[model samples]
Target chain A: MSTATFYDQVRTAVTNRVPVALATVVRGTSLGAKVLILPDEVQGRIGDDALTGQITLDARSLLRDERSETRPYELNGEPIEIFIESFPPPPLLVIFGAVHVAQPLSRLGKQLGFRVVVTDARSPLATAERFPDADEIIVAWPDDALTQIDIAPTTFIAILTHDPKFDEPALSGALTTEARYIGAVGSRKTNEDRRERLRAAGVDEAHLERLHAPIGLNIGGETPEEMAISILAEMIAVRHGRPGGQLSNAEGSIRGQVTSPVG
Target chain B: MNEWLPEIDQWRARGDQVALATVVKVEGSAPRPVGARMAVSSSGELAGSVSGGCVETDVFTAAQEVLASNEPKLLRYGITDEMAWDVGLACGGTIEVFVEPLSEPPGEKDRAR
Candidate 1:
């Protein structure tokens, strides 16, 4: 889209769930211009075909992950004097339960700028009225809801369908996808029990470890919101490769912004 | 830039001439990312940010020159291993920034046609 309406339309499209891409001149002679691109056409310009063609190709790759960045290139179709910065909104968070904890977890996730989707098999529990703050609340099985959308590495998946029958297929589907985080809510005994079931179901040990089964840092959380905080904390820890344990149990300096929430 | 549309539009509706600067790259632990950007108007109004804060002053200075000369320039800052340490990031990050003056198209003064 042209620079004029690019922000308005993109903001509305993103807040309304329409996929889009943004290409901007991040460097070179034409440093401050931009265009918005959907799957079909464009809303802005970067001179002409040679530069636009190259940037369109790059925009396609970033489109899948909905990423934003500064990418440099040449200008006048021959000299290097242009940069295309792409913005594709933010990725999504698909949670497979509307349990007591899902409320705060989804709330906190929204605060961090994630488009949260809370799903459940029970209609009463999955109503939008219950999750007034979530981006979407679907009253459907996890697999059915997930089948309708493509998953990205920026996506986060949670299996709070405490029951084994629901959590199994739910966990199975999430593990097979490219989501950056896959966590399940449970306990030590519950973790061992689930591991046995997943192993029996042909899941390998390596893949199974990827599942954060007790699903949170050891914060001794005793309530839904507290547990949500611990789970979010552990998710943060995993994203940055920090040890997910009590401060007394960890080592080395903690690094980077505490609120990045990126995986 | 489209990135500043929300702020730029608000400023433009009030008759502003905006200048822009973008951080194209970082050689070390720079606070801002490669695509970071900031915009300024002829009347000293500003929006967005390239560095979290440390390098914006330098960018503003460069933007003033771009506005005066109407010429884009690639300026480099933050050299490590220098005891003089002028205009360098304390975090020891090196950065490259491009500053330019944004102008209206021909026959499009009143409206950005």
Candidate 2:
């Protein structure tokens, strides 16, 4: 693509949360040289080897944050500059149940910037008509769906499936990888049953503890939508390492409490 | 730079002189980190921000001077407790801003018509 078009597309990509990088020659030879790169390949370039090499490294680093800038490098005795921007798409929310709670929970997940994916064995309950907000409505079995794809830290799991047959396998699929948050929508009795099933399947107790059974914060929310709000709030709190308790009830620094610090 | 482009282009398209003030350095708990920017138009209009409303007005003033002088300048705005309340840094941090006037805004002359 032309430089301008590539620049425009890269800009849109960042705005849309699509990962992208731009390479510019900030110093040395071809000081004003430039290029653009996505995850797959180069869309544009700075016209030299050293400059492209320097920018490619910078691009790899930009995948983590909302914005970042790197130091300048020289290309063949010439200064080169490049900026790789990440407009990474929102993380995926994989909900493995078509229960009553999943309806509003999935809707709330979308508002919280998650790309909602609802999957279940039952078709009638998890149809497009019932969930207009869900980006994907998969009628496949949760285990089957999960094994078919990789779940990165950016992916979140909500096992509202409740039934052990669906629930245990989903937990196995999730615990097998590094999905950021794993929560289950169920009652105390339901959670106890889940723990037993998980133990029977050889998932250790410590791993079982990672399950946020009786999912969501103790906000005393009873309704499905309110429950959804609390659940997502808890997920966000876990993701940011924030205290799940109310700030008013807490003491000491709102930051650096309990959790270690990292940028 | 890309975030401020819309306002920058609007001002530049109007043949309005502009000054770009960017925070290149900050010490301690600054309201704005390094690279935070603000664009000031000759009409005294502003686009974007460089602080938590702590020193933007002064930065805008510096930006005006950069526009008038047609030269790039670096300025220090010390805001820490070391500086009294009169210095505008009640938040107790300092920010150094670089103001540059853009006479040849990329792809300007051709678009001016």
Candidate 3:
């Protein structure tokens, strides 16, 4: 394919938030050749039949991991390197409650490249002015707003309403989705009472285990902004399957693998 | 690259030759992650960055060469390379950049037509 056509496809996929991968031959034979891998079809070609097939398989695996890297292959005493890059859609951070803490959380989420959506039943509270950094401000009930949004594996839900009316529904609705992190903000005593209510309402123990109650790392945060940082830190830790501990205490490299969330 | 799409598109629309330099591979304590990109227009305009203000100048020069030659070039930068040290990639990391021309060379446009 021509370079213009190849880039056009990339622009379309990226603008629409579709997951796509591009494989380019950076070294050895047929340098500069590219293959664009989409969910349903493959475009362009890397090289000859055998080499192209191998690159396609590797690119597909990297796409699954949402990773980008270069791999070297030895062919007939020649060293070939292909760079496979995956462009996954930005992760979503849904805040269910336009509380004071949500303001900072939404801002931080946007800075981290998340599509922040702040939703609340109170129309006055969930305004664009309040959450200038939020990508969306939906003035609707938690369940209603969440049901409309596509909650994929890259989605994170933060329920900040300490009130049972909104928190219970928000937790229940968020648990049904494939959100990577589902954190509920409340006190330890409040969480126990909330858990009992959820259990009485038929939320199973297995599902209850998925919830991060009294959310965020124990950073001893007192103010709303500090609380936002604590919550976001925990969300990042859960996303990477880390225990939210200090790097000095943690083993292995500073850059760790992003394990798929069991939640 | 994704963030610089509009700027790159404007450069293309204005008929200026464009080259894309991407960090395809990185090791050790690299400043930027893989897939970080730097775009260079033939008019000397630059967009985005692949490193923490360390190697962009050299990458821009390399990108101009790619735009002129219309051939992809693989460049390596690390502490092992004296130029990298001079350029201030002091993070003790190795990065491999793939520079490719996004527009056809001026000579090729006539031949294709």
Candidate 4:
């Protein structure tokens, strides 16, 4: 396929938030050849038939885990190198309360390249004026708003409504999705009470274990902006599977794995 | 690459030959991850980056060669203990960049048709 056609496909997939992979030949006979891999079909070619087949399989595996890496192969005793780059959709951060904290959190989420969605039943609170940077504002109840969103493994859910009427339903609805981080802003006592209510409402223990109650790291944040920082820090920590500790106290390298949210 | 697409498309539309450099592989603690891209126009205009300002100068020079010859090349940069004290990669990591000229400029496409 032509390079223009390949790039057009890439731009379309990225604009539509579709997961795709691109494999480029960095070494061997067909230098600079590219193959575009979509969910249902693969396009283009990387010169050699055997090398293309092997690279396509590897690209599919990398796309499944949202990873990009280079691999070396031997085609008829000749060294060949290919780079498989996976382009997963931007992660989603759904805030289920348009409170003071949600405002700053939504901005921070947008800065971090997340598709921020701020939802609240109160129409006045969930306005575009409040969350100017949010990609979406859903003025609906927590259950209805959560049901409409396509929550994937890269999604992060934050239940910021302190009231039980709002928090319980949001938590229940969020637990049913595949969100990676489900943080609820509340005190220890409030989290315990919410957990009891969730259990009574038939939320299983496995799902309950996904909650990051008393959200945010122990950073002693007091103001709403500070709390937003701490909460975003915790969300990043959870996404990287870190303990949210100081780098000075860490044992290994400061940089985590190259591929984030490794499955 | 996604972020640089607009600039690349504009460069092609302006009748400038373009070269693209991508970080295909990295080791240890490189500044950028794999798949990072840098686009260089024939007029010396540059967009995006593949490293933390350490290896970009060399990559830019290589991009010029790719643009001239229309031959793609793979370049490797590694930080050794001796070179680390000098002006080489101080990040103590290695990165492999692939540089290639774009297929055709917009003017060329219309002329060929």
Candidate 5:
């Protein structure tokens, strides 16, 4: 395929939030040949048919984890190197409330490459002017708003609305999805009360366990911005499957563990 | 690479010969992850970066050669302890970057149209 066409496919997939992978032959014969792999289709070619088949399988596996790496493959007894680069859609940050904390949280989330969306029942409060950095501002009830969004494993839900009217429904809606991180803003007593109310509402203990109540790392944050920072920190920790504690106290390297190469 | 698409497209529109360098393999510590790209134009203009400024100059020079020869090359950079002290990687690591000329020069597309 032409380079223009290859770029067009990539641009469309990325803009439309589709998961895709681009495999490039980095070494051996036909270096620089590329194959673009989508969920349902494969575009372009990476030279040899046998090599392409093997790379496609590897690309699909790497796409699941949104990883990019180089792997060695034997094509007709000759070893070749292919770089499989997975391009997952940007992570989603759905803020349930458009409160003061939501403002900074949305901004911080955007800065960190998340597609931030702020939803609230109050139309005036969920205005675009209030959340300039947010990719979307929906003026709808929590459950209804969430129904319109595709919450997957890369989604982060933050229920910042302290009011039971909004927070309860928000938490309930968030629990139904496969969101990776779900945090609710409230005090310790408030969290306990919210948990009791959720239990009364038929939310099981297992689902309640997913909630990060009294949200954020205990950084003694008082202002809205500071609270926003704390909340984002906790969300990041949860996303990386890490305990929100001092890094200095950790024994291993600060960086994440690297994945071993696949033969 | 996706982040640098807009600029790369602009360069293509301008009909400038361009070369793309992508980090294919990284050993040990790496500033940027695999799939990171750096695009260089014939005019020496550049966008994005494969390294955190430690190896861009060398990559840019190599990119120029790829553009001139119309050939692709895989370049490797291994930062040593002394090099790390001058450059800013916390630890020494090796990175392999593949540089290739674009399939079509930017101006050629416009001419074809």
Candidate 6:
């Protein structure tokens, strides 16, 4: 395929929020050649059929891991190197309240490369002017909005609607999804009462365990921006499977365990 | 790379040759992540970056050469005491950047997607 067509496929996959990988023969006789690999199909050609097949498999593996790396291979006794670059769609951050904290939280989410969506029932509160950083504004009930959007493992849901009428259904809807992180904002007693209400409403204990009520790391943050940072901290910790504790008290690598070659 | 789409399209629209430099592999504490990209135009204009202020000048020169030669080049940059005054990442990390010329875009209509 022509390079323009190859790039078009890559761009289309990325715009559609699909995981895609591009393998380039960076240090080979076929240098500048590329192959585009999606989950179900492959396009372009890095080299001959055998080499292209190998790169396609490797590209799929790297795409699944959301990693980019350079790997060395041998073609007819000659060393060849290929760079496999994976492009996973940006993670989704859904904020279910356009409150004071949501403003800074959405901004932080965008700064961190998340696609932020803010949803609220009150049209006046969920205006685009209030959330300049949010990629989407849904003026609908929090639970209804949650059900309407696509929530996958790459999604993080924050229920800031503290009222029972909203937070209850919001929590229920969030728990039903495969979202990686589901956090809610409330006081300790408020969370406890919220849990009781959820339990009475048939939300099982297993699902209740998934709720991060009284959300955010205990950073002693009182202002809206600081609270936003604390919430994002907790979300990041959850993303990396960390305990969200003080690094000074923690052992092992400050970056956590280096499990992959890319690190 | 998606972040540089508009700039790349503009360069192509202006009939300027474009070379894309991407950090394919990173070792140790690099400033940018693996997929970080920088685009250089034939007129010497640049957008995005593959490193901190440590090595863009060299990458720019290499990009111009790649654009002229129509060949892909893989470059490595790192810090060493011997090369302290040279172009190297001050963060003491190694990064492999691949520079290659991008073909002219299909057309403005195709770019809207």
Q: Which candidate is the best by DockQ?
A: 6
Best by TM-score: 5
Per-residue alpha-carbon lDDT of candidate 6 for residues A1-263, written as tens digits (9 for 90 to 100): 65556677888887678888888888878887788888888888755789889998888887776777889987777898888888888889999988989999999988877889999998899999999999999999876797789998989988898788888888987897899999999999999999999999999999999998799999988999999999999888887777888878975444422353333
Candidate 5, A79-188: lDDT as tens digits: 78988888888899999989999999999988877889999999889998999999999999888998888898889999999899998988987887799989998889
Considering summed lDDT, which 10 consecutive residues are worst modelled in model 6 chain B? B104-113
lDDT of 6 by residue, B7-102 (tens): 887887787878999888888877777788999998999998988768899999999999898788999998888888899987677998999888
Off by over 4 Å in 2: A1-7, A11-18, A23-34, A43-49, A64-84, A246-263, B1-113
Docking class of 1: incorrect
lDDT of 2: 0.70
Q: A1-263 in candidate 3: lDDT tens per residue?
A: 75656777887887678888888888898788889988888888765678767877887888777777788975556898888888788888999999999999999888776889999999989999999999888888878887778899999899998789988998987887788989999899999999999999999888899999899998998899999999998988877777887878866555545442110
lDDT per residue, candidate 4, B1-113, as tens digits?
13444689888778787888988887777887777899999899988888888889889999999988989999988877766654456677788999988766455577745
How well does candidate 5 match the true structure in TM-score terms? 0.87
List model 1 lDDT by residue over A68-164, tens digit each.
Answer: 4556577765444444445455557788888999988888877766778898888888877778879878777777877865688767787888898
Runs with alpha carbons beyond 4 Å of true place in candidate 4: A75-77, A200-202, A222-225, A258-263, B1-17, B81-87, B103-113
Q: How would you class the docking of model 5?
A: acceptable
- Which RMSD does model 4 reach against the true structure? 3.4
Clashing pairs in 5: B15-B106, B15-B107
Q: Is the docking of candidate 4 incorrect, acceptable, medium or high quality?
A: acceptable
Error of 1 at A157 (Å): 0.8
Error of 3 at A148 (Å): 1.9
* Candidate 5 local distance difference test against the native: 0.83
TM-score of each: 0.68, 0.63, 0.84, 0.86, 0.87, 0.87
**Better structure of 1 and 3 per lDDT:** 3
lDDT (tens digit, per residue) of candidate 2 on A124-225: 988998889998888888778897655887788888886878887888878867888999878899888778878898998778878888988999988888
Give candidate 3 misplaced runs (Cα > 4 Å): A73-78, A128-137, A219-226, A248-251, A256-263, B1-16, B81-85, B104-113
